[model samples]
Target: MSPRPSDRRSFLKTSVATAAAVSVPYIFTSQDARADEQKSSESNDRPLVGCIGTGSRWNAVGPNAMQLGDVVAVCDVDANHANGAKKKVTDIQSKKGVQRDVDVYEDYQKILDRNDIEIVTIVTTDHWHSKIAIEAMKAGKDVYCEKPLTLTIDEGKKICQVAKETGRVFQVGTQQRSEMGLKFLQAIALIQAGRIGDVQHVAVAIGGSPTSNSIPVVDVPSGLNWEKWLGQAPLVDYRWAKEGKQTKTRCHYEFRWWYEYSGGKLTDWGAHHVDIAQWGIGQNGDGQGASSIEPIYAKHPVEFKDGMPLQDDRYNCATNFHVKATFDNGVVMDIKDSHQDELGFNNGIMFTGTKGRFLVNRGKIVGAPIDELKDNPLPENAIAEVYGGKDPARSNAHMANFFECVKTRKLPISDVFTHHRALTTCHLSNIAIRLNRSLKWDPKSEQILGDDQANAMQSREARKGYEVTV
Candidate 1:
């Protein structure tokens, strides 16, 4: 039955109200109404979005952003990336007959300063994630940041706190949480329904961190601001080349392999795999992370501190290491390599429960025991319920989720507090590798129990002028 406009509005109001009463910590607040009204009053008549970091992911995100509202501005440290995105947005808008034009910027803060921009899509390298996101939220713009939510544990917590204080809608880019075929819904339902009979262990396999390879320092390409590209990270010689003489910019994807810019594969792939592990284990927001963690022997030989790599060149993160994280519920999450012949890439996770084990990744979900459960029948709208019944195919749905919360003041599904707990697990793995020893952790306090060195690793010194304040 088609509902009346007033009826639909009433339903939305009631849904939002009911959502608020559910005691979800991530709920949006009243400020969203003010923002909405302000947006309506502005003659722009479009939800202006700024893209920060226009590399690979932005290609997917830019078109989606345009469909959602308007890509008014695009920011990238590299001129090529910035101009590329701007041209793409222009082409899409032109083809669609949407007369909107987008401006390009090297500094994201300039985009933040504009009142017209209501949302910022952050697809920068891992290191810049928290710094720019926190600042954008503080600037009164809703943030849609890529995962792993933060580069460090402390950064994750700070982001959570700032979102709470500012009442801005923040969505972490963990699309698996929204992907229907992943059987994320099935897994969550089974776990929540006790179908797995109390999950005792979760096994996640992610790729190893990049190895340190010497690249000669190169000259900084023309039309690119090399210093600004470094952002908050330490200034390093372009490794393979010197400044000014460089033929190409050190801006974009290659930065992932360097410690100064990224956490290598640990933060790269671990962000996705570990996030699933955390979700399946039901550790989100104010929940304890892995109670204790230890590193498993690396199949490939690598230098170690405690169990972490000691070298700072090429790759500073571990290439091969298994971290055992024990949850408070006696659940052990083993983040390790998949048995080569048996599991191949081991790019997914295996959840072991009293009933049996189930494996899931982007493309597949398999289990001998749960095989019967698959055809047994899934509840109607089971997948939709996981996404709060939103369209899963929508690329900007996560951003839409944030915007909806901005107006309704409801917590996003991927709120900061919840993501913080998940990030704790990621950080623990890094710490275990760095320390090269098993360590006790207090998940409740989010600290390394009685270990000064481990505790110190929680936060790092932010580069000058780029420090984040909670």
Candidate 2:
């Protein structure tokens, strides 16, 4: 059976009231969209979508778009990936007895140049997230960018500014926000409801970043735009390798290990865990973040000078570290590679409060307080409430939210402003480790107080012809 009317209203009231009190512009309402727009699903008048960056992660989201709407264009710096994605979209439509002609391109801007596409999915590498997202907003398309939202702290401000100026729907792909029964939102609900008393400390345990030795340079593979792949990043020769055949250390999944293109595990898993941690603590929206950040310990595979890696051959991000941050309200947070010894958990958040504590992860939720809720669990309307009254068991809930918001002009649950705020903490953690020092952050000013060198690292110089601007 579905939830009752009163139960639905009560569930929405929790998040909606909090959103309203803070004046979040895109909170859901009964009149969120025109009645005619809601009928698009029945009439098959779905939005046109374009997929950019059809890498492995992109594979997860590409098919979901096909389920919701027509994917007419696919783009990627790697020709093989782009063409492969186009074929996938074409096949999906054919199976539905619909003939489609999906176009393929290497330059993403070509897809943006088309005025007919209404939505764009950006699953590019971390460094390219903000620039492409900003440009897409300027092109008047609703965007679904995967996390972490920005490569540096400065990119966060640019993304938020452009999103507001355009008034378009911008959703960050943090699926944990919508996964029903994951206990992420449930944890937030309990904290907001005071079931855990005032949250004293939150421990986030994301695993250590990968380490790699210097890789020998190799020739660029055919059908790949090596120059475009390195867009905005300093030009470096390709390092081609495969398992036994040719082990290329800098391509595909290995990109996460390098600081030049991504922030390693700090932004990888940290994006998901840290984002949830901040949300539960009531500090994820605009102008909300830690007041101070301290890098207690760190280790790296390469040397560093002035916060930049000195070597060009090996993975350079911190392999292991612990960062401590304090909020303005005196809430303390510990972000580390693991907490197995300290808390008997390694890949989840441990929220310690005055009355009780609990641990939450993808696998399970465990603790005395949660155990006490044997039969008296979260209300039946909780899933719908957290999802803005939509079905919680949706196979593509995160992408579904983005598509609905595109038509309604309402904010997706994982809005850009909040994602940027959460990502800011992750970026700061990387910076603190690179600098090997503590930092005083002024959340109001969004500045690293009294530290000129650290503040300078907030942004990097984009390569010529690829500079990102607001």
Candidate 3:
């Protein structure tokens, strides 16, 4: 028998209240909880999964759903996106002779209310990551959130805390961690094995930051809940122009170039590259952050004062910028864009060591001065040992890892604590470029030491009613 409407509401309220009582933690477990998870997977008829932020990445997640579990719900601010994912899941289920139906919703909260969902895949923008992941965890659902982890440094810390408290499996969507033969894995292994001969400096080059451009307001499309889409952000009219209606303004994917919505290319790509830098440098936890950040050069599309906009113009971020970060361990990480020649590799992480230097991006890895390392090879089991030696071809491995941990009440590999440290580097770069000055950072306190202006950039005031709380 179907549950009465009142009964369903009562159940949802109780579940949310119970989830809120859990407290997040600072540490996480690295072991796989497959033994416990296997029992649950076998006992249950099938796990019902939900997806939030159904964007382009949905294409990749579709096949994984068929093999892993049932996609019971899909939610997106855009109706088109929500419907698109719903169709995909239904079509796949139909082919398999599964009589299950996938529901669609414009608001993600609707999905959270359904007790049938065991997991949620989050592919929202950077800003929405923490909010949705935290709420989902509280609702007792395991989370598979896309990379760069948190939108802000504070959000990163909060996510870690929430995951620990809820005992929900949370995995950051940095798929390169699951990719085999990548330079990032190889570089870290070499450094750990002392093949790098006391690593001192590393160079990481990502793309540009946002600009100070104010686009004219446009009509919000039918089916798009613009207000809900702007959750946690100030309510503003949709400034994006329709297709073929080109203006001097940018929106959507171009939203990455705005301070309110994103941290430009630094966060967009840095989430991947800078993450690799953090792993190699061994700075993946609390009290483990960069000590200093300096913006050597920046060419902004508009003027600014210590990261604040001076003019309400078209763009608000830097068009070109170079930043240098010094860790307490005396390691210097230089992040810049190489205009000299494109570097052949536009976006990736590069590590330079005393022994040699290696560059790693998606599906590609190359090295220089390889003769010495080629002769003196790394340990046969180094890479596997670092990443727990898991198979790369396992579909949705990162998400699967999170689910395994959820059943055992263990933390996934890309837990919030480690991810926060990585995001700190990315955020600092954006802040430095905006301020266009050198700033001292106190990694121990997670604040900008001695500089009030720099410290203020750590977090922003959430729009009145959209504030996120513990």
Candidate 4:
């Protein structure tokens, strides 16, 4: 059993040694040497992995995890996904000359019960992320969970507490810190290097969510356990309908638009963009965040009451929003769907500071400040310093970092502590938009000040069977 919350809190405040991390050599940087490195460092002379929530994202992260460790099991509520993942894992191992049959199951607990499984990757839908992750850590397994790691603000806090108590190496799959051509990493380094004078305001144009009209309730798909798939969310009829010869769904990939399962673009994209914004502004740390969040404009396809959508059949999350969040250090972050009309990248972050400014996305980094870097170079170790003293230009990047940290017992680049803080701003933005109001936030306390109803929105009551027990 995990330790009591009080004991955990006491331990954390006094002797939690996250900063006392063990430095690991970049032995897993190349594919040819990764297996040899794993054999040398992992227990029992092999790294064993189990995967939960093998859905759309599993294709990307799951295979990468398999590269560092031998996959032993795969699980999902949908049998099709689980079986598909099993075959994929089996095929990948077959090529590596380590032929083995991978166990497939619908219950995630089965994967946690195995004593040999040292690592687990969670690529589930947004709502189920925190619970499975907490349980895995309690089971003494290291975790690599996908982004938008929590459905609610309080859930993120609970995950962080459990992680510290378990002493597990948990990596949040916000790969922007590690991947996307190293642009985001460089952006952070530039801001810290004072290439841009004091950051005055940052705008994240992550694009608006797609709005869908009333989707007709349809029969649950075959080979799917809808009840278990719903997990902590309230039971609702399976909804699907045709759109331009394509079937749009409330299940699987399209769950992002629903408020019940996900936080739409606010989190779907905010998890990547807002996280960078907070990091660039030095707010993605302990007890640091925006002092106030004002919902400048919010447009929804359906009306909401008490943060719940009045129209049950249509997508309800905010479609277009322009929220202004102010930090205690006198920086402002505007989360919006679009940038300047002339600058139509539609998806990028623009930083404005006293000295200069720049905009960076996955494709490119542009502006005068970036151009000046041709001659006005930063320190050699600038990017590595931002990345916690490791080389970010590795072959497998994020997954490789997780594998390395699993051996060292150190926190990875995107640990839960910083992610929860950055994600709090996203969650708060959703709350302000849902209520159509502004909020004063106490970052130190992690509370929405002066609004009891908004404070209560920080957590949701889990369904009886799906409570996220630590």
Give per-model TM-scores.
0.84, 0.88, 0.84, 0.90
Per-residue lDDT tens digits for candidate 2, residues 1-470, read 12245534543443343333233221111233223233433466778788889998988888887788877778887777887887888788789865556777777887798766788999988888888999999999999888888889999999989999999899888889888465687777667666678899999999997665567556455566655677888766566444455354766777888888889888998889999999888888677899999999999998888888777766787888999999987789999998855466678888888878899998877787788678657677764675677765757878887888887899898998888888889998899999999999887789999999999989989989999999
RMSD of 3: 10.0
The most accurate candidate by TM-score is 4
Model 1 reaches what TM-score against the true structure? 0.84
lDDT of 1 by residue, 277-315 (tens): 787777764756778888875432346644344443344
Listed per candidate, the RMSD to the true structure in angstroms reads 14.2, 14.1, 10.0, 11.0
Per-residue alpha-carbon lDDT of candidate 4 for residues 1-470, written as tens digits (9 for 90 to 100): 12245534543443223212212110112333335434544544458888998998999988898778888778887778888998899889889887555777677888798776789999999999999999999999999999899989999999989998999999999999999999999999999999989999998988887877678755556667766777788756666898887667778888998888889999999999999999999998899999999999999999888877877677788878999999999999989988765666689899899998999999999999899989988899999999899998977799999999998998899999989988999999999999989999998899998999999999988877899887
Candidate 3: regions farther than 4 A off: 1-46, 62-66, 209-214, 242-251, 310-313, 339-345, 368-376, 393-395
Would you list the C-alpha lDDT of every candidate in the order shown? Answer: 0.70, 0.80, 0.69, 0.85
Per-residue lDDT of candidate 3, residues 104-152 (tens digit): 7766877787666788888776677778888898999888887766667
For model 2, what is the error of residue 440's alpha carbon versus the real structure, in angstroms, after optimal superposition? 0.6
Cα lDDT, model 3, residue 255: 58
CA shift of 276, model 2, Å: 0.5
- Model 2 spans with C-alpha error above 4 angstroms: 1-44, 242-248
- By lDDT, the best candidate is 4
Q: Using lDDT, rank the candidates from best to worst.
A: 4, 2, 1, 3
Clashing pairs in 2: 241-246, 241-247, 241-248, 242-246, 242-247, 242-248
lDDT of 4: 0.85
- Runs of candidate 4 with Cα error greater than 4 angstroms are 1-44, 341-344
Per-residue lDDT for 58 in model 3?
Answer: 66
